[model samples]
Target: MLKLGWFSTGRDQAARDLLKVVWQRIKEGFISAQISYVFLSREPGESKESDLFLKLCQELGLKIYTLSAKNFEPGLRQNNREAWRAAYHQKVYEMIKHEPVDLIVLAGYMWVVSAELCQKLPMINLHPALPGGPQGTWQEVIWQLLQEEANETGVMMHLVTPELDQGPAVTFCRFPIKGGEFDPLWQNFKEKMRQIGLEKIKEQEGEKEPLFALIRKEGVKRELPLIVYTIKAFAEKEISLINHKLFDNKGNLLLEPYDLTERIEKHLKTGEW
Candidate 1:
């Protein structure tokens, strides 16, 4: 069986939900693997969401380890943050040194891991944009797309490198964000900005903007299923990491992402797991 190590901050309900979904899939035999252990960046009483997540893991009999970032942050000033992080990751490396961990999945880990840790772990992360698309958070990506008046957007699972959001994709799904479904909103957004000025938007909550909200909703609808599908691909060995590099089962290096748009659409239509 594939030995998976799950890492998540469990900062919000969505984080917990993602873990639950994966656990359920594993239980249903949808993924032929075992989550050997779970690592959290928060300790008990640090956050209710993480506490709840830990409670669930306990019920499921999964091994749990924690190295609290909150506990470690206070000792470091800005200049020493990088060095502190390296030591932090070293402690984590020690914690899991004996586990037979094959892969590390960053479900909702909020911290930027050190390059040293990235070198040590075979990790994959769920990014909110497609391969070769925007290079920041979902909010930044949506804003950039709107500014460019782009017609397409997507989500992907990519190898986690020291560079943020620039990793090689394993699997991805794209969808059109144009035409009838989008033009009305796009027009309204442009008109609103024209009347109110972009400065006002910068002052206000950008994520709550009507255009951003609509786009995020559409993207979120795909996030859960995309994560599940991508992990399924890894579990079945259609995609894998060999010597810390991504490749197909045949050992050919994956130069491009595997597209899953049609399969995702079909699965959405059937409403089956």
Candidate 2:
């Protein structure tokens, strides 16, 4: 069975929901794996949100570990950030080294992992955009996509390298942001951009813009299924990473994102986009 090492800052309800969903899938025999440990970056009393996340882990009976990163080496964190980041992750490494994790999943983990630690372990993260697409937080990605008039955007799980969100994709699911319900919205966006430009529209209505909201809604619906099915592939040995490159069970090199669009959409909750 694939042994999972879960890493998350537990900063939001998404963290709690992701853990719940994965654990539910594991219980339903959809994934042939066990989560060996859930390593959090904050402990109790740090923040009400993270405390709730910690509580959820305990409630689910998963092995919970924490290393409070809130104010570690305050002066050093402010002065020499790289040094602090490395030292911080070194301790994080020490905390979970003995658990015998087969893979690490960055599920909403909010820290930039040090290169040293990236080399020491195999990790994968969920990126909101497709491979070779926009880079940055989900909001930035969406804004850039809107600005680019991108018709298609997708979700991907990629190997975690030192560079944030730049690693090669392992699995992905793509969906169109145009056609259907989006046509009128895109028309409006184009008209508005011509009137006041992208920045001005953003200032007026940021994420709430219809096109942006619709894009995010569709993307968010796919995110959980993508993560679950990716784990399922690892558990079934249908996919594996060899020398940091993705390959199938037959030793076939996967040069592109292993397209899971059909599979993910099949499992997605019924809705029209």
Cα lDDT of model 1 by residue, 182-242, tens digit: 7888888888789887668756857887778888888887878888887888888888888
Off by over 4 Å in 2: 269-273
Tens-place lDDT digits, model 2, residues 1-273: 899999999998888888889998898888999999999999889999899999999998999889888777888989998999899999999988888777899988988888888878889998899988998989999999998999899999999988878988999999999999999999999999999999988899999999999999899888888899999998898888766777888888877778889988878756321
Worst 10-residue stretch by lDDT in candidate 2?
Answer: 264-273
What TM-score would each prediction reach against the true structure?
0.94, 0.94
Cα error, residue 111 of model 2, in Å, equals 1.2
Instruction: Indicate the residue-level lDDT of 73 in model 2.
Output: 84
RMSD (CA, Å), candidate 2 to true, equals 2.2
**TM-score of predicted structure 2:** 0.94
